[model samples]
Target: MPKAKVGRKKAVLSGNHYTSRRFDVVAVGASAGGFHAIAELLGPLPANFTGSILVVQHLDPARKSLLADLLLRHTALHVKQAEHGEIMLPGVVYIAPPDEHMLAGPGKIQLAHTHLVRFSRPSIDLLFESVAGMYGSRSVGVILSGTLKDGSAGIRAIKEAGGVTLAQDPAEAEFKSMPQAAVATGCVDYTLPLNKLGITLKNLYEAGSPKSYG
Candidate 1:
C-alpha cells in the first residue's frame, strides 16, 4: 500500500491532535463487494490520518456484523461500531450498527430505528445527507462498489452542500451499479480506482481546505 505524505500545515500528530478548516469527517456508503473495496480504500491512509470516517454498508439485520473487526486488519486507524450520542473523533472509523440508521450531528453521532429508506434500515442516503447538513463543506462523501442506487441522492446532497464527493470507477468495481448510479447524478468530483481514491483523500486532507467548485 502507498503511504500518504503528511502535510506540515495541519499534520496529524500522534494521538488525536490536528487542526484543519477543511474536511473533518468523511461519509462512506457501500454494499455488495464493499468489504474489499473499503479495505483497499483505507489501507493506504496514514496511521495519523486527520479525519473521522463514518461508514454505512448494507448488512444483514438478522445477524451480528463483524465489520469493524474485519476492517481492523486492513488499516491502522481505530475501527468500531458507532454508538448513539457518541462524540465523533478524528482518526476513528465508525461503522453503523446493524438495523439502525446512523445520522451525524455537529461533532456527534445519532442512531435511529426509524423506517427504512431505499428499502434499507442503515440507509447510505440518510447517513450522507445527515453529514452534509451538519458538516457542509467540512465533509467528504464517498460511494463505493455496491448494487442499486442507494448513494446517488446522498452524493448529490453533499455536492450541493459544497463538499467533495467521489465514486469508485465502475470498470474497477466488483459490483458497479452503486458507483455508476452516483456518477450518473453528475455530482461526483472524482471517479477513480480504489487505490487512487485513498491517495486522493490523503491529498485532499493535506490541502487543508475544500476545493472551490466555482
Candidate 2:
C-alpha cells in the first residue's frame, strides 16, 4: 500500500464512482473483548457529540446482538443496530447487525448478507472502507481490543483517504492482536488508551487540533 499524502487524489471506486468528503463519520471496529472497551471509548462523549458513529463488532450470527443495548448505558448518544437505508445522523451510534455487512455512503446506510470478508460477516474492513470512501478526511477509524487483524487494512484505507485512524494501545488492550496489527501498518495516526480516545476525539471535533503523542 502506498503512503498516504495530504490532499492527494480521491480513491476510485466502481466505474466513475467517487465519494465526496462528509467529514463527520466515525467508524470503529473490535472483537473478542469488545463490549467493555467500546463502552469505555464512547462513555466520555457528550450527548451532543457532532459526529455519527458506526461500529462493526465480531459476533455470532446465531445469537442476537445486545451491543446497542449494552452501549445505551454508557453514552448519551442515541444507539441502535443499523437499519438498511436509514439516514446517518450525528450523535447517533449505529451497530452493524449480526451476519450482515454494513456500508455507508452519502445520506444512506446499506446492509448486505451475501458474503463474508476474512471469514467474518460485518467485517471491520467493509465498514471502515465504505466510511473512508464516503467521508474522506472527515472520517475517523478506530481499531480497539480484538483477537485478529480484522481492522488493520481498514485503518490503512482510512489513512490513504486522508482520514484519521486510531488504534488502542496494545499495552492497554484486553486482547492486543487487532490493535497491534493496526499499529504495525504504520497508518494509524494515534495509538491511544481507551480512556483517552473519546476525549481526544472530542478535541478533534471541537477544535480540529492535530493530536500529538506523549
Return the top candidate by lDDT. Answer: 1
Runs in model 2 with CA error above 4 Å?
1-22, 209-214
- What TM-score would every model get versus the actual structure? 0.88, 0.86
Model 2, position 72: C-alpha lDDT score: 99
The most accurate candidate by TM-score is 1
Off by over 4 Å in 1: 1-21, 209-214
Candidate 1 lDDT by residue in tens digits, 1-214: 1222232222212222213547878999999999999998898788778888999999999999999999999998999999999988888899999999999987889999999899988999999999999889888999999999998999999999988888888888999999999989989877777877887777777767533322
lDDT of 1: 0.85
lDDT of 2 by residue, 76-98 (tens): 89999999999888788999999
TM-score, predicted candidate 2 vs. hidden true structure: 0.86
